[model samples]
Target chain A: MRRFHISRLIMLVAVVAACSKKPPPAPPPAPAPAPTVNQDSIDAARRAAEAAATRAREAAAAAAAAAAAEASRMEAARADARRKLDAAVYFDYDMDEIRADQAATLDAKVPVLNANADIRLRISGHTDERGSDEYNIALGQRRAAAVRRYLVARGVSEARMEVESFGEQRPAMQGMDESAWSRNRRAEFTLTAGGNPIRVP
Target chain B: MIAGSFTRGQPRGLDDGRAVAVRSYSAALTSFWLVCVLWGLRPSVLPAQDPVASGVRIGLTYDRSGKPGVALTPVVGANADSVRLILGRDLDFSDRLTVIAPDSGDAPVGGLNYVLYARMNAVAVVQAAVTPSGGLHVSVHDVAGKRVISVIDVPLPEPALSPDWRHAVHVVSDSIELAVLGQRGISSSRVMFVRGNEIWSVDADGEGLRVVPGTVDGLSPAWSAAGNMIAYNTLPGAGGPSKIVVRDVLTGRSWSTRAAATNMNPAFSPDGGQLVFAAGTDGFDLYSVAPFTSDEPKRLTARKGSLNSSPTFSPDGRKIAYTSGILGHPEVYIVDADGSNADLLTSSGFGDQLYRSNPSWSPDGRLVAFQSRINGKFQLFTISVRDKSARQLTSEGENEDPSWAADGRHLVFVSTRTGTKQLWVMDMESSRARQLTHGGKVQNPAWSPRLDFSRQY
Candidate 1:
């Protein structure tokens, strides 16, 4: 096919060369040089080549767009993971035993930990304003440690979790009732040294 | 399930519903007295046993410093009824002696006479006179010995030592108690406690109540040994950490905490040379910082995972008792001043290891008062440092945050048994508890050390 195209290209060039000999005053500048090639066929071949180039450019652009969309979707998923993991899981009173309800919150963090290996968590324990501040702090730590144990069980690395207890120092609600107390007794998580969620020191 | 003893607060943080509300039962007191007068059935003499109700344990053990079985009568002076009431109430409040009402013997100041005090078998007598300088001159007499003990002259300032001479009378009454019984009285010391967003201080005599200025949501106010400064915790902001601050209660100067993110519960050493505070940097642990010094805080506890807070030094400054949760629950722990010999003072051997915290060591180094969960209520408990035995002091209320007076025999704590939290002082021996503050929710009562004995100015 290459040889045939080259020979055809040479034939066309020779025909044009002969036609352009400036034939002895060029027959009074007559606009003529036609008879050697098929005009309709040549025009058709040119259009086809232009169409093929246009299609190639369009195909390249589509591929680039698909790649960009995939990157953005991945970023959004990571962001969603961060939001889900940054919340706290609460417990029942005087009980470090994470209730079944609180376990659901901990379970939400599993995928975030698995998907992002570099992400580390800082879990702070907190209690209500009912008991001694010192005691609540320790209880808060126990609650946090309990959550951490659950995360470790769910395949999250232990080294990625740091625990601190705020005790009654940090309360999520404000009151001296069961409703407020229940909310305060919990383990809160914050993304540290990795993804952007919240930082609690 | 043990009920959650904790409460939560929103953006404002741990309001704890401890807004102080105080009441004095004035109407009931008046009605009871009126009924006695109307029926002509008023008892002219104090009972030998001295009812001693209302959690008040009156002390009759007078020292050899004064004559025994002394009787006191507040002589009607310029503010006759007022003076009579002030002095009369203080005498009753002293729990030290029997105070004879002036009206009972009010034939006339001179006519009713000094012999009657002796006739009442009272050997000690107090003669109160309003001096020409508008000051109060009280001369205590050993009626049996027939000699004057000491005279206390209290000068009335512009504000008149707390309006209506309430505080003036308190000073004089405290002097009388001191002269009669060699022990100093708490009637002159001011109590600083947290009431809502402010730190309110009330006079020992229930006069001159005022909120400490220049504090933003201050809590756990600790009175310095010298009674010059207060160390407390101030919140960072909404959803922020707490900072330990030392403010000159007299000058209103501020000294910020070096580290932040969780520093609170600052307490002064007995000597006032150092301050121990709870820092949540690594964990809730106790750290000591010198007052008004740039020195770094020395770590007093290595309780990393376990929380330790409320550190108070013994009178000798040789030991410290604090709350720690090392045994999976919170209990009172004692350690050497240098953070050595860390041992549990309260036992987990008890049911489910009842929660115990807020350890305030007595000045005498014999007893440590703290609050523990009992029957789902927080009650005041004092543990003997020598025997490691604990005694529950309060049963009617949820009592916590105990502070000791200079006497070491008396302590003040917060009780919520009356629906609203209030300050109550209890005597260790007598098991008598006196409500110090009423109305609103009061927490974190810190009794001042003996500032001074008396002043003529």
Candidate 2:
């Protein structure tokens, strides 16, 4: 393909040089070259041009496919990041402090939130079914507030977060045992606005 | 007349029945003169055992150690059977009277048989006959005096077993209690509670259970002092903030807080002019707003990093009791209505079992009832406001959210004693508990003040 382009360039230059020069009187017809040789040169040049065009088309198609694949991969990454961001952080009974085990779960969300400045979230706090509903609401609020504070301290904008409490009203699990209670006491995150594709950090 | 010991340090009378009867008649005449003299003077100057004060001048008296015995004669006329049953239950539940069911032979013939009633140790006999005007002609006879002491004509609304009819029967029972026990009963009041995300109201006698119209997805329901309005918290939708909703239960008019934050634990002021609740982001703080208007709410507490909730007003509306997490654990606290004089009301640091919430001020302002976490379960407790002494009221199972009845001697609370969360009414004076609701998880019971059915809200 390179040789074909080079020969074509040389022919283009020769034609330009000829055109620029003063046109010579129509040259007398030289002795006729072999008709078979001239046909063979013309066919060889046509074949080279077709081959180069095919190679360029193939290269463009490959590049387009690569771009689509890259876009799809980015989209998948964003979705995964969103899921992690939406993941809830559990709390101990009657507690609002972020548990050590939940640190990594919350830290994973920080980068995603920092990268997506337009994203707004609502952090709702919940509690187990043991305490008074009204008090549980307050506890839930503290949990949500604690989460908001944790994120804000980690460079996430506080204005992008809104905190609320469900108390024990919206339990994630239903049971009288610790298995259900441990899961119920949590802070859940929801994307309230600006849910655009996010870049995973 | 049966000679009985008196609360007052009076001389012992003869044990012979006939001799004591003659002596009692003479003493009764003397007590009548004493009562007239005492009536001319201030009640404070009168002795505690004054005949008038002790219901003796009215010919009915009971020993302090025992509840007065009252017999319910069969009700006559329309819906007699239902009225009799309701009245009998009300009187029995009063805790001030030991109601006796009259036997077939004990039925009155045109007039009450006071002699037979006296022989049966009945202090009072209640007779009810339906009038032609669709009303109950109730008569209370003092068996000892063999005379009718009180007669109340209670208008019974049409339709037997209806809420209105039941309420009227309750009123008659309260009247009977007043005629006999010198104090009205609490049967006429109603209790509002949360039943599966809906607000429901039931009479004090556990009848007339019905959901309040238009109150769905509500929590922490509270009745206003006038028994006309109710304040409760509504669950928030996705990404929305919980809101406090106050509704006029009779007219169905509702008002909601305008703030976009978590608002909960609504309590109406004693005057029903203001609604106080906990509203905030992160940690809740107490706020008060005019419940009937859309005006901006006034902040009552601004303690950052602490949650303040479950507010209840004192009977006089001067002070508010609520739960606060300022000490790193929830504890009952009291503050003036104007947001001043914040003080810890519950004793804390009891070996780290510091959780106490849902403070319900007694109608008498003598105590505040709250739930405390003990041994990994919640139990009902009442702390004296004056002495700060605490008394545990429940131990069987988890109990929480206690609201006092109008009489101040009873409370309605949620308990898991039956293995299912249900509403239970407890007579605080007698330490007697009766399950008011069954077969469903119900909570946050708020007992209403004495409801006046004749008054339009």
Candidate 3:
């Protein structure tokens, strides 16, 4: 009985030591030697050891699964933020004022831009092919400025935004009808810097 | 009898002021008489004016209904056919004279058959002979007085069909017009325009079409009055800002603004000492900088919230005409060079469709030509600076971007009349337009002043 106590104590010590290691092995190490022990007790001791080993394995696996899930969540958030940042705000024919319908489209970008403090955006304004190219350039610029002003009013830093105008040269849609003109007259957002792994709000 | 006393290579009887005035009056009267005769309106009696008593004035009358017929004799040289063709076309394009082909039975170089020419309704007969020293000796003969009026010797370079050779031929044509009409022709000038992403130039006579070197992705090219430099805007890269570039065509040297904003629509001052352009970080305004120098630009217009662009200078460089969107839409406006005395130039006659832009001030400071949106199409219109009267120059297919010739009598604009965007030159007096470019989609034509090839070479 005294020997059994000693061996059991030894097994407990060994298991504890293994568990303290940096990375515990998938399968537990062998148990310490037992001298002159009864078969029932030995079997019970062996079962107890196996149960402890199973518990250790499950803890390690759960930790690994948790880490993988966290990484995937971060990736999804980054993609969503990038999409919001790249959304375009459209304008009316020969008009530079942003329509009320486009407010939400531009507002969605504010939180993402505010969260990613390192990010810089380029707001390029475009116009439909209706007026002189020179005049259209100015009109397009006004559209982009309107967008920048909207973002500035919504807590996005003015220093983080840059504006440009493409006039009537670069069109999103190629047609003479309103369907194309509406799409062509827009302010597009481009990530000029710090876009990788965009942090979401 | 007067034809026998003429010397070669000299203007006869033009040295004295009285003689010049009398000769000019006589030429004018003769031009009128030739027009009447050509239109089959024969006057029963000549005006009761004695030729000798009028101090060397040729007896004739006055009417401005027709263009006098001028004949170009076949040139005698190695590249005679090309010379004759170009010269003949130049005269015809002038719109000041009617070019007639020389008959096979016409007189030789010095011995022109004035009686025969008069019967053919030719008031002035042009005779050109290629000299042995690679030059053209052109003589103008007055058929009415039967004398050689003026002679011009034009120097030609070697190897025909070259740009230099063509320019020399155009100079000869201009000399002929000067001798006949008391004004130089625009044949020696060139037109600068934008095609695709490049800037191209062609002779005023629609010859020597070529892309301007170093002008890739160029737009809205403006030629200086001196014809030595050109100012244009560069089409920026993705998300980049446009910049204004001024280039010296003779030296191939260039100067550009180093601004990180949209800078475009550059117009040279009349003196070629400064350049006015539209540039801003958000809304554009007019700014002027001395071209080919490191001088900082001066702000000409600074209206906030409203965009101002497309600047053109008056002849005296004291007034500037431009387009402004101050009233919710674009309209033509004029201001002093210092950005004062702003006045609305275009009338609201079109009623609520008031889109007028691209204001090009005429060289004579008389009119400001611009494009206005009318009935869903852009057409060319000119507004008088004196009377504020507006005249529509084009009514057919879409015409825009009007650039006046140096004479202020011709306008070059982009037109879609022939199913494609091409350059067309319109004579303001006759309302006749001739196609200037046939290849590629062209726009933003700016006609150069009478280019002096003598200074360039």
Comparing candidate 1 with candidate 2, which one achieves the higher lDDT? 2
TM-score attained by model 1: 0.69
Counting only residues 3 or more apart in sequence or on different chains, how many pairs clash (N, Cα, C under 3 Å) in candidate 3?
0
Task: Report the lDDT of model 3 for residue B4.
Answer: 12
Worst 10 residues of 3 chain B by lDDT: B16-25
lDDT of 3: 0.79
How does residue B134 of candidate 3 score in lDDT?
A: 84
Candidate 3 has a DockQ of 0.48
What lDDT tens digits, residue by residue, belong to model 1 across residues B84-161? 445655555555555543223333223334443443445566777776677887777766556677788887554443
Number of colliding residue pairs in each model: 24, 0, 0
Model 3 CA deviation exceeding 4 Å by range: A1-73, B1-65, B103-108, B238-240, B454-457
- B397, model 1: CA deviation in Å? 2.8
Give the better candidate number (1 or 3) by lDDT.
3
Provide the lowest-lDDT 10-residue window in model 2 chain B: B15-24
lDDT of 3 at A3: 100
